[model samples]
Target: MKELIISSINDNLNNAVALLDAIDSKTYSDDSIGPYYSSIGSHIRHTLDFFDCIISGIDTNDIDLTARKRDEILSTNKEAAKSHIHTLQGTLLSYIDANTDYLIHVTDNMGQGKVTVNYTLESILAHANSHAIHHYATIGYILNQLGIDLKIPGFGYNPTTPVNKREGI
Candidate 1:
């Protein structure tokens, strides 16, 4: 189960990297719907931190999230921040694989009974991948609003293209 989860998420994360790579660095600063919407950089960071917080079961300890200022959340240096964003998803996969046998039942921030029934290792992994894909779409929307054409990294089909296979060059 863990293997399946890891493989699935790894694929999504890799595709996400491909999509991020398609985006020019300048678009990182492009604003979304509102000032509080957070630029692309913030979206990238939020993608990782939010998932890690949920999975790690230590969500409240995340200081960055407490920031009400949009600038603070979105101000991470472009190249370095993107690199970290790509790395985190892979690490999450590894973490889940290593701890597959153990069940993780974490409550959400609202203290709601958000039971994570990790009956199969794949369950958590699938959730994370789906979570990331939704965020990736946000990345696209931001790029679209910026009017920056999304470059498909290669001569053939790219990660940004809608397709079944998530990863491409």
Candidate 2:
């Protein structure tokens, strides 16, 4: 289970890496296209921030989803975003042998107010993976608006989602 989870997360992160490699800096930081006007780099940074939170609090067993870095450089620089993803991938690899079932406290605001809840390490990782995929889908939309084609297959789709139903396929 641990191996599978790590593999899935790594695969998703690799998609980000591939995108960073394919696009130019201008396209990465371009926010001119969209109703929300969010850049592809911003989505990548936001997705990485979720994993950063996990890495930050995992040692203490207290994860705070709101404690994001939100670094402007990461939001606009493809190189910085790629480096951040690489660091996260290494950190996750180090935890491959750790106990996945260990309980941890996660704090996040789910509309009303901030709340802390118990979650297994595996569960939180799964959540983060899903969160990353969600952001990737948004990034895909931005890419489409920019006329950029993603070379990675299933880059912005959940594993369970049907290929025919995927947006911008």
Candidate 3:
């Protein structure tokens, strides 16, 4: 189970890595898109931040999802984003076959106020996987606006999505 969970997390993280490698710095940092005005780098950084929080809290068993590094370099520099991706991938490798039964205290806001909920390591990993997929979809849109083709089929589609309906299908 731990191996499967780690693999799932790494899959999405790898997708971000591939994207960072494919785009230039200008495309990465561009926030000129209307409506939200967010860049692909922003989405990548935000997606990785959740994994960062989870990994940083592993030793203490206290994960704070609301607390993020928000590193500017990650949201601007393509190389920096790629480096962070490598770091996260390596960090996740260490957790393969780890004890997923350990209890993890997750801290996050739920409309009313901040809440600390208990979850198994596996469960939190699952949530992080889903979170990454959601952010990747947004990044895909950003890439589309910039006219940058990642050429990665199903880059942002859910695994269970019908094959014919997928973006790159």
Candidate 4:
């Protein structure tokens, strides 16, 4: 189970890297799009920050989701974002055989109030994986607006998405 989870995370991060590799800085940082006005780089950086929070809290067993370092460079420079992704991938790989039974204290404020909840490492990792996929879907939308192709299979779709739909059925 641990190996499977780790592999899934690594695969997702690789997909993110592929998307970044396929676009230039102008496409990545452009936020002139309608509705949300958010860039693909912002989404990717946000996704990476969640994982970073998890990894940083592993030792202390206290993860603060709201206290993320929203680095502007990460949202502007593709090379820097890729480097951060590789760092996260290495960190996750190192935890493959480690204990996940310990509780992780996750703190977040969902517009109502700040809430601190307890979760196992495995659970938070699962959440982070789903979160990254959600962001990737948004990034895909942005990519489409910018006229760039991800060129990576299943770059944004959830795993349970029907194959026909994923193939544009």
**Reference-based TM-score of each model:** 0.62, 0.94, 0.93, 0.95
lDDT by residue for model 2 (1-169), tens: 8778988899889988988998999999999986999998889889888999999999999899989988889988899889988989989988889876778999999999999999988889899999989988888888888877766788888989897766432
**lDDT for residue 148 in candidate 4, whole number 0-100:** 68
lDDT of 4 at 7: 90
Q: Which number leads on TM-score?
A: 4
Instruction: Summarize candidate 4's per-residue lDDT along 43-111 as a digit string, tens digits.
Output: 988998899888877798789998899998999999999999998888899988897776779998989
Estimate, for each residue in 23-84, the C-alpha lDDT of model 3 and write its tens digit: 78888899998779998888888988898999988889889988999998889988988888
Winner of 2 and 3 under lDDT: 2
- Regarding lDDT, does 1 or 4 come out ahead? 4
Answer with 1 or 2, whichever has the higher lDDT: 2
lDDT of 2: 0.88
> Per-residue lDDT for 118 in model 2?
95
Estimate, for each residue in 1-169, the C-alpha lDDT of model 1 and write its tens digit: 5666666666655655665566666666566555467677777666566555554552232222222233343345566655665666566655653644545543333356333333233454455566666766666666666676665432123335667553322
Model 2 TM-score relative to the real fold: 0.94
Cα lDDT for residue 8, model 2? 89
Order the candidates by lDDT, highest first — what do you get? 2, 4, 3, 1
Candidate 2: where is the Cα deviation over 4 Å? 166-169
Write down the RMSD of all candidates, one decimal each.
Answer: 6.1, 1.5, 1.5, 1.6
Off by over 4 Å in 4: none
The whole-model lDDT of each prediction reads 0.54, 0.88, 0.83, 0.86
